[model samples]
Target chain A: MSGQQSTTSTSIGSRLLDWSLRGYVVLVFVFIFAPILFSVVFSFNSARFPTIPLESFTLHWYQTIWNDPDVWTAVRNSLIVSVCTALIATLLGFCTAYTDYRYNFRFKSAYLALVLLPPTIPLIIMALAMLAWFSKIGASGQLWSIIIAHSVLTAPFAMAIIRLRLNQMDRDLESAAWNLGASEWRTMREVIVPFCKPAIVSALFLTAAVSFDEFAISWFVSGLNKTVPVLILEIVQGNIDPQVNAIGTFVFLVSMTLVIVAQIFFTFRAGKSFS
Target chain B: MARTNFSGFATTWRMPIIVWQVLFFLGPLLFMIAMSFFLVKNYRMVEAFELKNWEKMLTRGYFWDSYILTFWLASLTTAVTSLLAFPASFALAFKVSPSVRRWALFFLIIPFFTSYLVRIFSWYVILAESGVVNALLAHIGLGPYTMLNTKFGTLVGYMTLTLPLVVVLQTFALANIDRNLVQAAHNLGCSPARAIYAVIVPLAKTGLIVAALFCFILSFGDFVSPYYLGGSKPPTLPILIIDTTKSGQQWPRAAVVAVVMMLTLISIAFAALALAYRKRASR
Candidate 1:
């Protein structure tokens, strides 16, 4: 107690606490990653069931899926839906975010509240609603039905991301461009869009990732045009299938790559590369 | 000023998005409410104004059972996730350096970006009766335990969904708490454990509660987890909705359950927001 560093017992106790805490964080990370690691590992094992004492490492499942035409159809559908959803969601997001950024209007908060509300609703309810509407309108079971639902589901995320980027824009950039004799649309095309390009790209990748991995809505609305996740679900329903593991590994890689790319662009400053 | 025509163009900017959101997002939700009141005739939904779907679903014992089970399961997930996440979050908040904390945040967020269904499916393998967990248990002289196709498996799926996100949220909340208060408590002869409970926890109460609430919201609405991992032995509300719609084409009946779920979420969200922002009584 005589000096700040004089207590020997407290020093050892604190050190023990520090090491234990570090160990706990390690354990939590293991818990998070273990299932993913197992999924990846079992995807490679030649054994059909994911049992212990792993079988000889083989790519037969991957080979089998590579030859399967139905799997290819799912992969194609997933790509089309995700790509279309990404473009539409990002466009809507930028417009909404720009509106929020540039204007002050009545019911603005309510407008925003509605715009941002999709992610909060239970997905099942969202699926049910989408299914009912699509079926009623004679649009159920189409690939585009999945696309439209995913856009609705993911546009809020797009809006949120672009809005963040917009908030960081200099207040006068658009104004200065307009004052310099550019037309409103030109200023928007030249200044605002370029300024928002990185965020737009980032939003596109993010929404695409979400749409790619999305299952519940796709399952409900995609009457016959199955996305990859729906196909995986069909395979795994009521029984185990090694085909699912192979498809899952591929889907995981695709989603993770998109997300990582998005994160990279999101962290980049708009003009930093040129600068 | 160029600002003269700005407002007009602003309308041009927003109208399309507003239309999109209203048409696709808000329209379906409102339609869902309407669909709940429609009648199903001969395995087809007929648009009408009636409360039979609501009354039927509301009065049924099975529907209410699912409601209660989903409620309790979500609450259990919230409670467990909060307790389990606290220590790791606390460590990240106070024990780690800033760089380590940032890396930790990135790792936690990576899981959110991946396929949540894949994560749950992975558990299905490990928790299976003849799978890895049981295989490992045999090596330890412990009898294999049945885990899959039970509430336990559902809980595991719920954990997979909520844990990483909760840890990310709770870590942010705890890290924002002032460190000096904790130090001051320690200097006042409070033990380390007491300082955490007395000072740090009180300061982070709102964040912790909100994080737990988010966990509740995620687990409550999840469909794949309860279906695949839990084996849909007794269907959760999400699975119930699927069954109703699938078997009899009772889309109206399914809509009733959807409406109830939405109402529940909106209520819980409002309640949590109130509690979180409630002004403290004068000391």
Candidate 2:
């Protein structure tokens, strides 16, 4: 009878803990997501202040941003920069990671450290340095300059993801391809690139998102050609407009879609690779 | 010739990356440091070297205060983030189904993909005097107190911004724990809570430290949150550096702060690594 009672009490205790754990998780999710939900909701809010007494919904803000040419121009510039940056960063990152993984070389750790160092340095410092260096080289205040700067910032992240994927790959597959009279280039194109497709896709998504939304360096470097983020900064500093919220929500949705799509592709590929 | 050329191609794939890093990244960093040593006279950079900016930075009370505030806020954020992340990750790792966990992770990481500027600005909108938090408080016959431009506001922003990273890291770590060990503890009459605390935590110590260190460094260097949320009373280090460089064109002064910030981060990283190593050794 005593054993039965003890078991009952322990079961109750465990059940209570479980309820609290679920409750805590839900509360945290709400807290973390509150601002994002608010931003989306307020993008359609009729109120100009984005504050409450719960105003009626309207799509005026979105319409306003839609008709704004500056917003479009900024978006176009950002897209151009992001595409160029992602392509350059991903290709270079893959090459660097492949070299490091495929060969046994002296001072490899030191070289890898140099690759990782750019991201670790504070952004303001790097931006300031880049601005000065670019000006000295007569490359400041240009779109290409912004692209190069962003590439420097994002390439490390790409390299990290690619290197991790490379590390997990089967070396024997590559060796077998080589042994089957396949050229090195052929082996890489057929076996290696296909295997690393998920990482490369993820690299593209991540670097593009980073470049699209990068602010500090772009702010310093892109003198006349403003990216959407820099334009947002200008609006933010100038006025309190709901149109900013509308554009922000749009950017949020687009980037989220890209990441979600990439994540699904990656997870599926990773599942296949593991099996 | 074919063998030699193929070998050369194999090794030389690294050349473009090396050249790029050398010219753009390393060269600019060195240039910045060199610029910092030069004297600023009559609002122009003089070729002559001077330690005046460094002296000014070290001696200034404001600079020290900013450093202290940054460290305090970063530590607080790390603690708060870990407290919230650990339990959620535990629930995900053990309680939830694999399919649910995957989707949960997706939802968790989705917010981070948004423009960081917009994410920070959303807090400004949500925490304003008449905003959601305050409005809810007012409904309860409580505060319409200012939250938009305060240290508390900044803290909240940091917590939200860093949550996805902390949760992701901790979840990955928690998922890697050996299930048999947890089961063994249960068989040994250990309560679920005790098993998690005693068995799972020690095993996951390295990952936790790494995650904490990452949170600390990111929050410490963060200019966006503090700039938007933290009021102008006592600026954070990054804000100070940016203002100094932009307004005064004081490259050397800014560099001094940057160097200091870099050194502090490196030391903390080393210290955390040492602690992690010692913990393993003791085990």
Best by lDDT: 1
Computed on alpha carbons, the lDDT of every model, listed in order, comes to 0.88, 0.83
Give all TM-scores, in the order shown.
Answer: 0.96, 0.94
Task: State the DockQ of every prediction.
Answer: 0.72, 0.63
Best TM-score goes to which candidate?
Answer: 1
For residue A256, model 2's alpha carbon misses the true position, in angstroms, by 1.0
Model 1, span A1-275: residue lDDT tens? 33647788888788888899899999999988888888899999998788898989989989999999999999999999999999999988988998999888899999888888898888889999999888778888999999999998899999998998888788888788878989989988998888888889989999999999999999999988999998988887756778778888898899988988887788755536322
- Please give, as one word, the docking class of candidate 2: medium
- The candidate maximizing DockQ is 1
- Give me the chain B TM-score of candidate 2: 0.94
Candidate 1 lDDT for residue B91: 94
- Candidate 2 ranges with C-alpha deviation above 4 Å: A1-6, A273-275, B279-283
Give the 10-residue window scoring lowest on summed lDDT in candidate 1 chain A.
Answer: A266-275
Residue A210 of candidate 1: its Cα lDDT?
95
